[model samples]
Target: MSVTAITASTNSSSVRGSANATTNCLRLRRSHILFGTEKRYLSNQCVQNFRFTKPSNECGQRCIRVEAGWLFKGGGEQGSDARLERSESANEDILIFFYQLDLATRVQYALNLEEYDIAKQLRNKLNEVEAEVIKQREMKRGSSSKSEAQDKGISLLRLRADLQNAIENENYSLAAGIRDQISKLEADSLAATIKAQAFEKAEFEFRLGQKVRHKKFGYRAVVCGMDPVCCETSSWMENAHVDQLTRGADQPYYQVLVDVHEDPNLLVAYVPEENLLAPEEPDKAKFDHPYASFLFYGMDSAGDFIPVKQLREKYNRPRHEVPYDPQQDQTGDDNA
Candidate 1:
């Protein structure tokens, strides 16, 4: 079973007062069977009110630690070692289930289960992942020169990390072994953020961009962005431009963004491109539109602005299946 499935099965309890003992025993056996292990010594009294998570531990130390190849070691026996070695094969399944959890979620799960030691281990794992991410960023930027590479270990940029090195140092053989370790770290997590999010579908000739100016707003003013009108467009525009700019209406219009010289407040006017013109005094125009960073990735060396990543990561994040989590832990899990 998956970790989530295991957690759910372990956490669930529904039995009559008379049958509680029988239910607990049966369930415990089932769990042991599922884990491919014989039952460990657990008291009947403890089984009566059993919970997968720790109920009371003032110091909040984890009672159990799940490791990849740990064989329940302590007493030396080759037979036990053989059994443990066999357990490792079974435990590989458990490790894969654990990793399916989001990094933050795994930490929260440990903390909520009162597994502080496990949480600490996960925190350490987080640091390693973050270090790998920073290293990848540096490697992509070619920051690992000879001296710098010696100072920081061989940085892996992933996907084409080896390719970049091979091309740089001209070693094609090792480059062929490149595997994309980056797929795990590239947490776009911005699936909700729409790309090049143009607000209106009104057929217009000029592609909406900054550096455009409002005739009445004067020289310093620039078109920062366009948005959809909630109600009809504001009636402030001189009757020359249609007032309404809501989406999906006849002659749908855009709420053009423009800065006012006198008032520092953001000014959005519902109008067509005809209502605005290119900045007459190009020298005075400001291309540093405030919304550009959120909308566009930084400009390339060629002076051309690049759009942000259009493709997004999956949005279906795992939900908390276990109950009885503390409020603070629950809040952190919500963020995860």
Candidate 2:
């Protein structure tokens, strides 16, 4: 049947697997949301919209969704109109994340096979990826913050002008309303600046792209994003049992990509920092996730996924380099 829109909701099931690797099977409830007559389905990945010409098994599969000419959005009138319905940031981040993951995976595979030369080349490439991630992050921060501030300044100027016009016209009521709006806008701008500063000062125990395990649930996950403090609503915080934690919901929270092999339905998870810990040893095993292909460049010697440049920039995270271990190559060679 032709579909216009679809919504998914997740429900938890009995945990499965080893005690240290338990996972909840999440079931999605489908519902319809009507947009234009164009058929669309909710995507499991960054691709938010889809059009299907035929009934296919791939309907519910995870993928990075990109519309035709997505890059051209906001380039012209048609582009400007389409911008209202699409966000390019998530799709771009997924593409970059996949690249990093692929590179890291190849590096790990080469090392596992005792191909030191190939691993060396991949390692060099990993360094290059890290540099690019740092560059992109700096550029995003420089440009985004500047643009946001400029936009806010321009808006304030226009509102002030309107307030002046209202007063000149002896429209006291209109002037009062405009003055209130201006005050609120200025207050919001100040709050934004404060928030940005807080983010810069925020510290966390975990870094982006680190591999971690759930202390309570025993699920393996990789860090993709983080907040200085828990940012969920009160209701969500209660449901998540955040109140019971010794650190409470004031601690850092992370956006993690769950291993699909463990729980295919639990794609992206927002977890508290207190609930996560770095693995005791490097996990050499493959980490299976639908978004892994696009969200990470490669696995490091430490078994952590290298997040793509865009992904790093999205969270304002710095690039991380795996420490060099000369003995690692010798060990691989001995194994070979």
Best prediction by lDDT: 2
lDDT of each: 0.33, 0.57
- Regions more than 4 Å wrong, model 2: 1-197
lDDT of 2 by residue, 1-336 (tens): 222121111111211112221112122221011111121222311112212122222433333222221111112353232122121232233434554555566567667767666566657755665566556554433333444556777899999999999999999999999999989888877755654554567788998789998775666888877766665556666666677888886667777876655544345667777879998889878887656766688898888999878677767678988888899989999999
Model 1 residue 273 CA deviation (Å) reads: 2.1
RMSD of each: 26.8, 16.5
Best of the candidates, TM-score: 2
**Which residue pairs clash within candidate 1?**
none
Residue-level error in angstroms, candidate 2, position 319: 2.2
Weakest 10 consecutive residues of candidate 1 by summed lDDT: 311-320
lDDT assessment of candidate 1: 0.33
Candidate 1: regions farther than 4 A off: 1-202, 219-252, 259-263, 280-289, 298-336
